[model samples]
Target: MRKLSCLLTGLMLTAVPGVCMAQMTADTRLGVGHSVTDADLRAYFSIPPSGKGLPAGSGTALQGETVFTESCAACHGEQLQGNMAPGIGADKLIGGRGSLATNNPVKTTESYWPYATTLFDYVKRAMPFNAPGSLTDDQVYSVVAYILAQGKIIKADETLDATTLPKVKMPNRDGFIADPRPELSLYR
Candidate 1:
């Protein structure tokens, strides 16, 4: 009787996993929201520097101004100067050009960000302090263009898309240097 009980328990454990695996591998489309299609998989992936995974849609600085005013102005000033209110310390996004040499260097988007693609990526992933991860791809591009244009990084007419976004040069593009420290730890 003990041997039979042990055998049944082992069989149940093995069979349960097999059944679960089969269900997971089987018609995933009919299951809960965990099942994802190719399109769904594509949406969550990050866009590379080369814009390999860039989603469709385009935006201009003009349209971006509206979006920024509506969603961003409450915190980052209407002019994109960042949130300076008491207790809120949002960084400025415009000026700081040619200030890196000074004792007090201002690191705004125009002055510090290395790549234009980073702006789009960051805005898409996080922004609008009150709410994060809410902006769409097109909105991010448009907001990036608006901020860049305001900072004099790019011309007003230049539209930021996957192709052109990578091309827009940033002032501090060459400011960053690779870390020289060894990655492996030798702590005591």
Candidate 2:
């Protein structure tokens, strides 16, 4: 009787995963989650450096400061010094200007990033450390504006949107050389 029970439990354990996988791969439904749709893909699409895919909303540095305090300060630090926690080491967002040429260069946002648009793209795609892609476009824009303002990269009053964001040049704007390789020409 004991041998029979052990054999049944082992078979059940092995069979459960297969059944779940089968359900997950089925065309109709997974019984647990709905299939991804085109709209969902569009929601998570990348915003290129040209600001081509940036949403219509806009935000200011003041508004961004509030949003940052609520969503980003825990991981990135209240002053953007970066969290010192073991696994949650968020990067410092401000300063580090003119250090790129030095041996101990501190690559903060103001000093390292080549384009402000890329900042917007990164924040939109992955941020808040815990819940990525959860912030609305306005919230993302506000946080970006705040960070840039803190770094002195842009005026605190400067409003960032699709048109203006791509124009806000970074301190290292001219530092990056264009890729000379032919295979990567399409990206240029």
Candidate 3:
């Protein structure tokens, strides 16, 4: 009787694993490999400086001003000077053209952004603070134009398109230098 009881217990334990495995196999229906569509993949990805993944929309500065006044002026200030509250602070987006070497430099769009593509890409990915990338292509273009104009880089009447945006020159275009660290040669 004792031997029979022990044999039954061992058989039950061994069968339990098999039963679980069989149930799992029956419940699941996944193939070896599957992927999302190209459009779905693009919805989540952002474009970067190398122009790796930009979208096809175009915008103009004239269109951007209306968008900026309606959406951005609250936090970024009416002139892009940045607003400061107790705990909430907005970034300054214009000026700081020649203050990079100063102790209290005011780094802004005029002095900081390396390329115009970067500005467009950044606005498209993140802007407006409360709601990011909510601007239309034309709105984006206009807001960029407004900021650039405030920075003294471009005129208010100037229209910005894909071709003209990249061509616009910033005052601090050559401000950034390539990294040369370690100081090994200097020490030697």
Candidate 4:
């Protein structure tokens, strides 16, 4: 019994170091995660309403139509209308101009979204439903232009880049009032 007890104690102590060393040699640091690089952080694609984070790219609504037809139409529908049919659910992209004041409001791109830059940001970051963040910046701009044009928010011929997209006003630009919550108040 005494020998067995020491043997068990010896085995446990031996196993403890082996388990500790195992993680050290496995290329992971304390099981936290891989070290992040600037590229990884930059990949988030968080473009503000100011269009500041927009990457270098250029495209027109005409070009966007092609990209949208190929990548977006499946989920968004043939007319950029929402897919509420059976199991296919997606938001409508155009034509809901005056519904905000109505009881049954249909908030589409033209009716609800305030900033054109946000449209580009959303498409660039989370779009095509199936493959998020797959489209290039140029394709994002084009798609934004196409959707805006369809809603008559922007001219069909207008080219949407970082510079112009922020400037293109939407119907709902003034829909949002300044958030006047007390906590957000400036120190007086």
Candidate 5:
């Protein structure tokens, strides 16, 4: 028993150093020292504020009504009034024209969004919640047209394309001002 114990001890001590060195060598080889190019980090989807990323298509409010009825009405409500769950299920897309200063403000596209481009970008990125980026460019344009029509910002017959979308002035066009903090006034 004593001889066996000595043999086992001798074997363990001999094996330990080799194992430790092998582990260290492996770890060094797997160290975090890699480079990623711009292409690797590029965004798969993005929309600029100038409707720069809008695709080549056009649609009208008349077309959008069909798309909205088919794809969006279930979650966003029949009139885009918003559904309330444990949290707000969906955002109301209309009927907040002059309610920003009030306690119960309704911040819909008509009342809040300064740029039509922002609307196009947002709808293109994450909408229909369940099936994002699923709408064709024409469908997206139509939906925007429909929402704009509902908001009373545009006529139902107006066409919405990349060229015309950016020109649609929202009511709150001048609502936002560039941050002017840390100026001469602040120093005083």
Candidate 6:
């Protein structure tokens, strides 16, 4: 019994170091995540309302209609009225102008969005229902131009790029008031 007790004690003490070494190796973070490269950061970078970080590409409303028909029409509908398919609820993109004051105000892009640049950023980040971030910069710009033109916000022939997109005024541009509280990184 004494020998058996010592033998068990010896095994436990021997096993403790091995377990500790395994934990220590895990803390080393070897074979974990790779360091973030410039390209990596650029891939998921945010586009501000000022049009900063917008990629270098140009697209017109005419070109945007084609892209929209192919990629966006499935969820957004042919006339951008949105699809309420079972679980999929796509938002409408136009109309609702001056309806914010009404009880039945529809919060479409033309009536709610404060900036055209924001529209471009949203399409760039997420769109096409199933395939998000798949559209090229030109496609994104064109789509924004088409939606804006459809909403009568801009001329159909107008081209939208980083510089021109920011300059395009939205109907509700002054609708939103700036936050009085100090900016916080978490909110951003």
Residue 143 displacement (Å), model 1: 0.9
Better of 2 and 5 by lDDT: 2
Per-residue lDDT of 17-125 in model 3, one digit per residue for the tens?
A: 2232112222235555333344444445455445555555555556666787898878887777788865446888988877889897887888778777688778876
lDDT of 2 by residue, 1-188 (tens): 33443344434533643232212232555356554443443454466678876788898899999999999998889999988788877878898898899998888888899888889988987887788889998999899999999999899998888888998988899987777888786742
For candidate 5, give the lDDT of residue 53: 56
Estimate candidate 5's alpha-carbon lDDT, on a 0 to 1 scale: 0.76
Find the number of clashing residue pairs for candidate 2: 0
* Stretches > 4 Å off in candidate 1: 1-33, 37-45, 87-89, 184-188
Q: Better model by lDDT, 1 or 6?
A: 6
Clashes in candidate 1: how many? 0
**lDDT for residue 73 in candidate 1, whole number 0-100:** 82
List TM-scores for all candidates, in order.
0.74, 0.75, 0.68, 0.76, 0.70, 0.77
- Candidate 5 — which residues are off by over 4 angstroms? 1-45, 86-88, 181-188
Of the candidates numbered 1 and 2, which has the greater lDDT value?
Answer: 2
- Flag regions of model 2 displaced more than 4 Å: 1-38, 43-45, 185-188
Give the alpha carbon lDDT tens digit for every residue of 111-142 in model 6: 99998887888888888769888998889999
Write candidate 1's Cα lDDT for 1-188 as tens digits: 33443344444534552232112233556764453344543444456666666767778899899889988887788878888888665777899987887899998897788888877877887787777779887888898889999988888888888889988889898888877677545521
Minimum summed lDDT over a 10-residue window in model 1 is located at: 17-26
Please list the C-alpha lDDT of all candidates, in the order they appear.
0.75, 0.79, 0.68, 0.77, 0.76, 0.79
Better of 4 and 5 by lDDT: 4
